[model samples]
Target: MPTPNQAALDFLLNRRSRPAKTLTTPVPNRAELETILTAAARTPDHGKLEPWRFIVLEKPALNRLAALVDQRGNDLGIDPDKITKANAQFATADLVVAVISAPVDSPKVPQIEQVYSAGAVCLALVNAGLAAGWGANWLSGWASHDRAFVTEGLGLAEHEHVAGFIHLGTEKNAPPERPRPDLAAITTWVDA
Candidate 1:
């Protein structure tokens, strides 16, 4: 016999990310968000490298980042439409947690494993937000991958990279149920 957390399993079965643009004001406060971050920090890490960190982007920081994205897009000769979309991604959000993949050098752990740990943190954060009754979406775009944008806007280290920007806020509208992957199509059974 196995003990199972039914509530957690139910939440996982129904969890869906709300659209970033659809999230409104009334985001989690510092203490509340700290709780969510604490939950996110519980993600499994190979070698315990702890390769992930969070940057909470409040409204003012988001606004500044939005402007920086515009400038960087122009400097890089990116399409104007892309610039606008990315700018809106930041400008429209009330709160975001930037999951920074800060991989540390470890002989026991490969760099790719550290990177995967960071990615796991991102998903954990999104799930934490959702479980806490806040709408959350994990996002990343051109600005996140642009060196100048991350270095100047977020002050990331040379080795650190953005795993994702987990946007969190009040849900304006419940998103419709989207199609999920077919288990049979993607699953494999092995027996010996």
Candidate 2:
């Protein structure tokens, strides 16, 4: 039988991501964020490729990103509402961890697997922050998908991509629980 830690199990069972828009000040400090990042880095990486990294964006960086988002929105002729929502991510963020999916060349590990690992890191970071009593939300708007934004705003390499932008801060208010997926409807038990 596998031994289980009750606290950890309980946390996972009830885990919920706080709304990024509702997050306030008193964000995690450098040391604290480093600890969270370390925990997040413990995700499964096929072939030990470690095909992911993080970029911490604080006040000034967030402001710059907000401006860049606006610029890109205008250039792309995006809807004003969509542009506003994307800009809000940076303008309201107390702190954000940009999970960069930096795939590495390897014979054993597939590129798709490396991308999956990067996604896992993003979820792990969000979970770690929530576990540490911080309000956290994983976000990726149209700006994140824009090549100009990725290169100029984040200085990402050609092979790198944004996995997520994890916004972290104090919870302004408790978010109500939303509808959950029906396991029976989605799950398939196969015996082959």
User: Which candidate leads in lDDT?
Assistant: 1
Tens-digit per-residue lDDT, 1-192, candidate 1? 999999999999989999999999899999999999999999999887799889999999999999999899999999999999999999999999999999999999999999999999999999999999999999999999999999999999999999999999999999999899999999999996
For candidate 2, write residues 1-192 as lDDT tens digits.
999999999999899999999999999999999999999999999888889999999999999999998999999999999999999999988799999999999988999999999999999999999998899999998998999999999999999999999999999999999998899999999999
The lDDT, on a scale of 0 to 1, for candidate 1 is 0.96
lDDT of each: 0.96, 0.95
TM-score of candidate 2 on Cα atoms, chains taken together: 0.98
Local error of candidate 2 at residue 6 (angstroms): 2.0
